[model samples]
Target: MFTKILIANRGEIACRVIKTARRMGVKTVAVYSDADAGAMHVAMADEAYHIGGAAAAESYLCYDKIIEVCKQSGAQAVHPGYGFLSENAAFCRALAENDITFIGPPVGAIEAMGSKSEAKKIMEKADVPLVPGYHGDEQSIEFMKNEADKMGYPVILKAAAGGGGKGMRIVWKAEEIEDAYEAAKREAIKGFGDDHMLVEKYLTKPRHVEIQVFADQHDNVVYLFERDCSVQRRHQKVFEEAPAPLMQNDLRARMGKAACNAARAIGYEGAGTVEFLLDEDGSFYFMEMNTRLQVEHPVTEMITGEDLVEWQLRVAAGQTLPQKQDDLSISGHAIEVRVYAEDPDNDFLPATGTLTHLRPPQESAHVRVDTGVREGDEVSIHYDPMISKLIVWADTREGALRHLRKALNEYQVVGLTTNIEFLATLAAHPAFVNFDVDTGFIAKHENDLFPKREHITDDALALACLDVFITRDEEAQAQADWSGDPFSPWHSTSGFRMNDDNHHELYFVEGDDIITVTCHYRDEGYVMELPGGDVLVRGERDDNGDLAADLGGRRMKATVVRHGDNLEILVHGRAHALKLFDPLAAAEGQDEVSGSLTSPMPGKVVSVLVEKDQEVKEGDSLMILEAMKMEHTIFAPMDGVVADIFFNAGDQLEEGVELLKLQGE
Candidate 1:
């Protein structure tokens, strides 16, 4: 076994690899970019080296720099933890030339499965089930259009070198093919530096099931069951589970054999995944193969009680297979949900800010949190916005899902938006609970997940109001010697005044609406003038700093987390973000800023489609901004003429920066 190895990636995956390497009595080196100077992985490594700038192009993608670091650190091998240089065949050969072992598949295997079209052809030759589509090398608009026409409507365009949902588009009609092709090409070029694409038949209500296949240098291969990644959004897997919910033993065996065959056909070594699109009728077709560890590999690990990273290390060290196919068996059910720093209310847009509070679930024997971020860390817009992966395991699928809901509820983060609430909602939905999931699960049940709300609940609003009142009192008494008792009733309540009543009014902003609430102190309770009607509420803080409230004879418990003027209160199983409103500021900033297109997140302007005074209709594409490795087109909200263009193409922009102004006709 190698004495030391260097991880050629960052974030959770690199951290994950380091843990296993340490367990195997191997020292690990971590390479980081400027943006990750204070990253968790760098701190965890026995030795660390700086590569380059914050951008991946200047850092992780620079294989020469990584190779030089490996030589200086005396790392015997390089483990390309998924993404970055993980699947780069050239990098693998470069390491071989330098006498450093590459802890992944050989160059031949990578080249064979490097391109989607080439992989499809190889799979067909190997007698693996293949999908009906055009996987040709002719990369022209005319050729692609004709191929889509022959494939009929509802075809999917995928980048020849795409993975992780980038450079993918689905065309539902003939007229949409041209635009879809162009957009997919642009994204492909930007993401992978390859504009070549292939058209595939769009599967309806298909479940994304993938087999975890492993191989060693000794020509030994085995399949470790499967994971169902059908729960997706924007073609990205958000949730995954092991041993697909409705899979039968026969289907499992067939898929396992097919996956193994696909791996053996390419002479694959190390850890890889064979993805397939399983139809409702139990028929499956091969998708592209990922040549490294998958993001959701924890599910498979939980089911088999195996450490895949350890396996990768063992394979790279010329060790024989750890376990034969007959020795490995599924032990239980496991599920994983990706926690991202995004706003679910705002279409899951990537968010950037300081992590003021990050409290992951209390992990136990059955639950685990794989992450490389901590509280007070900055979630930069320079890379993927994934915060962590929450994995849970149980004896049964239903039990694991039930634990998933509880885990999400226990998870909490402040200072920026997240998808914790959104995940909890989906986990409890009827369709998901009943095992009726697919790639279109989110779209098919959008209404039930994000229901329109008329008003905030009375309890929630009351909690917010109380939070504001307590915060103000604490600030006022910070310097005073008001008995160090934190939960003193005297400090929280209005002083006992004979023949005098105290009334307090406060305003809070939930979203765009400002709620005005009046609190009148009574003998023991308080009368609140809410928007719905008058209600009596009583609340007090305990020594543990949790609030117990009684609103109109109903009891509820809540905890308020205050960050400056912003408050995040947890009631029941959901969390709400509210800001304390100031009447003076509201009056000064009452004018609505309309008729302008602003960048949703910090990004570079890819293209400006209009000039000053250019007329545009509603829904017209105005500009394209690339951020978080995704392109977002700013569109005209109404029929208007562009009055001003603030930024030109290739200019970096901060979030909420107005890109262009429009004057309505």
Candidate 2:
């Protein structure tokens, strides 16, 4: 085995490769951009080097810099971890020219499978099953439209050089074709620098199942079963699992063979994945082959008991295959959920901020976490927003699902918004539980998933009030007249009678209205019996005069203050700011609260679409903000005029920052 290898990537994949390299007694070198200077991957490697700027193009995509780093660090080989320069045939060729091993497929295979159009041609020639579509090099708009017309409506426009859902769009009608084509082309040029596209017939209910294939230089290849990546949003995979839930023995055997054949046909070596689109009719078609390790490879590793990165190094070192096709057997079911810094309720837009608190669940016999970030690291807008991959394995699919759900519940991230709630909902969905969903599941059930719920119970309100009252009573104890006021409710323990008759009114907000509850003290704490005959538990004040209470089975930390005849209790991160009103004063101080549009997260303003005083319609793109390497367009709240623009392009704004003011008339 090589003594040292340079990982020409960053994030969890880089850390992942280092882990296996270390296990094999090989030294690992990590390369990072300016943004990743203090990243977790850098800390995991034996040695680290700075490559270039923050953006991938200046750093991770700089093949020359990576090669130079490998030579400087005396790395015997370089591992491209699935993105950036992973599938670049020219980069692989250059590595070979430099006499440094590239731990991936040969250049010839990459060239054949890197481009979607060329991959289609190669698959067709190799007798692999293919979908009916136009894979020709016709770039004219009219030609694409005519091809789409022939393929029927509801076709997909894909960038010839695209992956990871970039430069792809689905058109459902002729009128949507031109706009989608233009958008796809523009994004393609920006993302991959390739405007060429291919039109394919859209499979309405397709399940994405990919087969893992490993090959060596001795023309030996073996398969590692399949992964079902059907859970997706915006064409991006959200969750994945190995040993597809509904897979049959015959189908698995046939798909495994086909995947190996495709790899062999391209003279493939090292770790690669052959992706397929399985339609509702049980027919599967070759999608494309990824020429490097995948983000969800942990699922395959858990089921097959194989370290694919180690296999890559061994194969690159010219080792023969260690096992034959007959020797491989899957052991269990493994499922992986990609934890990202994104908000599911906000159209799944990427979020950027410092991760003030991040605690992934500890790994156990059934759970593993692979992450490239720590608590203090900033989630920048220079790269993908994926923070980590949570993988769970069990003897059965249901067991794996249950394990994954429990792990997700224990996963904590405090600073930025995430899709944790969404993942929980997905796990609880009946279709997902029964494995009856497809790629379009999110789009079909978005309405049920996006709305935010505010579930306030009467028990919670009572608990909040009691918590605050205890805190205030503790503070008043130092000045209470407890010498001879036993019956006056101020002469018992802690300067307040434990068995007194005192009444206090608490006010809180529920939705748009305020609710007033009256509680009378009985024991050490208030014991107002609910009309439904349910009991409530309240806590005592701590040394700091703060009370903690269990309200409706939910814990609450509250601080209570009293002024004159009004009682104020702070709960759930809000200050309440309530006013104590006599029945006569309440009628005189009733007014409605107004609403305003605020920035949902921190990011940089990319473009301001509307000028001051401009009239805009609802759903119109008011401004575009770039965050976490993705652009999000903020829309108008309602039909209104732009009263003021508080921010312009290049302005750095914080979450809840007022970006604009609207006037409704």
lDDT of 2 by residue, 1-665 (tens): 89999999998999899999999999999999999999999999999999999978899999999989988999999999988899999999999999999999999999999799999988888888998899888799899999999989899999989888877899999999997897678667877788899999999999999999999999899999999999998778999999988899999998988999899889999999999999888889999899888999999999988888888889999998777889889998999999898878777877878776566778998999998899889887678888899999999999999998888876766556678768877887888889888899888877665655654445545655665565466545644644434344543333333476566666654555566676665554565444344445567666645566765466766555455543444443322334444554554565422424677777788778899889888888888775543456688878888888888888987777888888875
| Candidate 2, superposed: residue stretches over 4 Å from native | 456-665
TM-score of 1: 0.95
Error of 2 at 157 (Å): 0.6
Task: List RMSD in Å for every model shown.
Answer: 2.6, 6.2
lDDT for predicted candidate 2 compared with the true structure? 0.82
Highest lDDT scorer: 1
Please give the CA lDDT of all the candidate structures: 0.89, 0.82
Task: Count clashes in each candidate, considering only residues at least 3 apart in sequence or on different chains.
Answer: 0, 0
Candidate 2, residue 591: lDDT: 40
TM-score, predicted candidate 2 vs. hidden true structure = 0.82
lDDT string for model 1 (1-665, tens) is 99999999999999999999999999999999999999999999999999999999999999999999988999999999888899999999999999999999999999899899999999999999988999898988889888889988799999999888788999999899888888888888999889889998898889999999999989899999999999998788999999889899999999999999999999999999999999999999999899999999999999999999999999999999899999999988999999998877767789999888777889997899999999999888888889999999999988898889989988878778788888999999988999989899999999998877546677888878766666556665663445576565555547355676688788888888888898887776778898778888877777757688888888887888888778888776677777887887655545557887788888899999998989999999999888866778888999999999999999998888888889999
